[model samples]
Target: MAKKDYYKILNLSRDASQTDVKKSYRRFARKYHPDVNPGDDIAVQRFKEVKEAYEVLSNPHLRDQYDTYGRTDLDSGDVSHGTTYGGADSVEVNNDVFETDVDSDIYEVSTGEDPYSQPGGGPEPGSDLSFELTINFENAVYGAEREINVPTFRICEACSGSGSAPGTKTAECKTCQGTGQVFERDRYSGEMSLVQCKACYGRGKIIQTPCMRCNGNGSFQTYEKILIKIPPGVDNGSRLRIHGKGTPGVRGGPPGDLYIVIKIKDHEIFERHGNEILCEAFITFPQAVFGTEIEVPTLDGTAKMKIPPETQPGTIFRLRGKGIVDMHTGARGDQHVKISIVVPKNLSERQRGLLYKYARTTGEL
Candidate 1:
């Protein structure tokens, strides 16, 4: 096979930073990992290529050699001193292939560059936020609108998130030449790598005069009151999404999304399974003996059900379309009611006499 360009294989520029290399490696590895793309020959081959590229590019000495002499340095060159490259397919040596101090089981761990870093100017998207919302069972069955307070970062109105004091200007970061990144050579291996400039916090500019209210942070933490519309048929552990309601992004990036996790409180009268509702209703002995109509509680309102003659206890009756509705299909599930016979505990004198007389007439007069 012809030699592949390590940078091209990783989709990185020649001057990409160590963090960018690691981040790209993680992204490509995760997408093409054998476990993720099971039984796919192409993915398997691509995963091998990514791992090989990362192993070579991640090491300072090896990367420097590869940059100067290309892949030929692995065979024989001035840059091949302590660097080693395995076969075209796999990690051949038993020693550590990665020298970045990251986990050896790279696939199991999340290793990437700062998600908030923006390469082409502007800020990266804010991190996604999660909030658990506890709601009543009725609200979960029938939709409800609830007002909630979420703690998050909001843009600093004092300086409009620019971090500079009013009437002051931002100066270009000299350390990174307005790129927000600095290149440094390793002391031992003399290899070059990119790192975020500490002075600008990767902003490519410096706030000469810090904002007094936000202290140059560009945002502050405060409570935001938002009305969340809970849809019907949402169960416990269900998640509702509200876009652009999360933390304020850095610089001019778009805000992140807010995820509302539903925690349905237990109901006193009903137990829900998927879209179906289950409950138990007690009927009098006379009602069970002779056919009678009884009222049962449903999510909507009271529903009348007919109890058949000689109906035994523990008989389950289903009322169609009386349960929760499906969120996607709009189809409703059935409400199942289990029957319980309630026998009379105490009898009046007339009632006892009537029962005794009836028994005597039937057999032992």
Candidate 2:
């Protein structure tokens, strides 16, 4: 069977940006979601297809593989006729066994079939998983480790993923006589083709007794606790990749990856913009008039900042290299302090007199 064009499925062009892909996927997903179109098999199938397309296109590695090889199964040996081992002439050698030498390796060729073509049983890559993690502001700035529980699927432990009960055996499929295939004739063209047997689903065997734990499904769902390392300088919307920590593979295929989307909690005193930190400090009128030092809060505790003489209200001071560290470049950012002048609401008579005298001397009263 021909592979579906993912771009078409998403109603996008091949050059569509990642943002475009995401937008289209969300639109299609909402329209065809199972809850929205309950009892509609066609809508359910469309939703599944859209989800599959999004999964492949949203990943850079998988998207690149799909673009280059026209498929995302990176480990599969199947290729186009021109790229096959025996070249164009090898297309007709489906049932013929031939030896080919490439890079000092000899491979025996057989009928061209997808490694995962069998629906009943075959090695299939696991689906990638995503989760959102919210960390403290300090943790986002300086790195921390956390433990989280993720619910996912795993191979059944009772029957060791065999789908058979303990001390039980399987029987050959009677539909195809253990061949796992049956001949089907096309109604219009009257052409015959060998297709997978529906009874055994191409596994050629049936479990006489199903495993009580997994119900002969070969896998089960459970919650797994995992320890994750969060790097420094992770801001809101930051993504971290954890390899082989997603859903377990099927039939011994490789497991998918886990993606953690980071959300930084808002700080009580500090506000972040990119790598820079913004904070406010209030000073008395005298302190702003005559230079004075004040303590300012920082990630490493309070630090002293000098208030220059005649500093205007809303004046900003920069403390170099006191902000967050860039995770990619390893460079530090600066912290900015905005100074605000405060006037005493309740003042002693002597203080008020001194202030009036100062204002008169400065010609401001």
Candidate 3:
């Protein structure tokens, strides 16, 4: 049998610093932790090897003895040149090993003091909530107030969020003896580690009687009506944030935020391009040939615009300060009107005669 190299196991050199050793250990531990790779035999073996390597390299005295004699075992009394090293003593792991909660991205480490063992437990912030809302195109351009119903979880009022009936008290968890943690020995590695207590879920205390209304859950689902103000010039895919409007927190922690994703409806008469407005207006052939005044739709109301003589079809005219207002700069944009010529389908006998005489004069008859 041969001894494994501690430095090689951690992917470090013998001259690596203590900080570097600890950093590599945390990275490997997170990758091979039992909770992260459940039921994987290969990962479990790698985790045990990483732990053993860290235990020897983290201690200064053990590292010096290994460097000199190439072995850390002192119980055999095989000393070179009558040198004496420290006898076998239990090694205390100062650096913490972490267990991750994938859903919440929370890390539970072996820190001596358990947060849930405190008087009122710990304050955990609520999770943020998001919702999508659709608004009218006019409302998005000019802005308006909208009321929406959001269904979410709220703290129960029956037992005041305690999860217990009135006058009933909570008792200490016997499984962990109120310490919120328990020591367990690994069957394969024969190493002991502290893990969160499953009985009380690391809460040190357990409710004696469950709440009748909430069924022992601290919160209940309900619909909340909230009035939100939409800012002007908001386009589709705009997001609005409301503070402290999400789910209720635990143990007096702050509530999360509420997010509203905006979706704008299509308009029949007008189209928006950034802060600018675009619209098409139909004009008679005579009106386009000779100058005339026409009415066009705008954000405020209808506005009159003048067309010049000899104007061609598809000519564009601009009306200043008739478009949407800029939300941030407070500046207004221009409205563009595209001209389209309309030809009469039916012509009277007298009108046809006059048109034939005009065509003869122009040498087109």
Give the alpha-carbon lDDT of every model: 0.71, 0.72, 0.69
Give RMSD (Å) of candidate 1 vs. truth: 19.4
lDDT of 1 by residue, 1-365 (tens): 35578899999965454567888999999999999988999999999999989987775445644543355445543433544332111212112221222111211111123533764347666654666777777777775666667777878999988888989988898888888888879899999988778878777888899999999988888877776666666677665545566667766776755656677778899999989999999998778989789999998779999989989999999999998876534589999999998877689999889878987998966
Residue 361's C-alpha lDDT in candidate 2? 100
* RMSD to true structure for each model, in Å: 19.4, 17.0, 22.4
lDDT of 2 by residue, 181-242 (tens): 88899899999978778897667789999999999987887877766566667677665555
Rank candidates, lDDT, best first.
2, 1, 3
Residue range 1-365, candidate 3, lDDT tens digits: 25678889899865454556787899999999999999999999999999988987765445544543346775343434444442112211112221122111111111112232333366655544656667777777776566667766788788777778877888888998877778989899999987778887676778899988898777898878776566666667554545556667666776654556667777898888878889999998878878899988887889999999988999989999888776544588889999999887789999889878988999997
In candidate 2, list every pair of residues with a backbone clash.
Answer: none
The model with the greatest lDDT is 2
TM-score, every prediction: 0.56, 0.56, 0.53
Candidate 2 minimal-lDDT segment of 10 residues: 102-111
**Quality of model 1 by C-alpha lDDT:** 0.71
Model 3, poorest ten-residue lDDT window?
A: 102-111
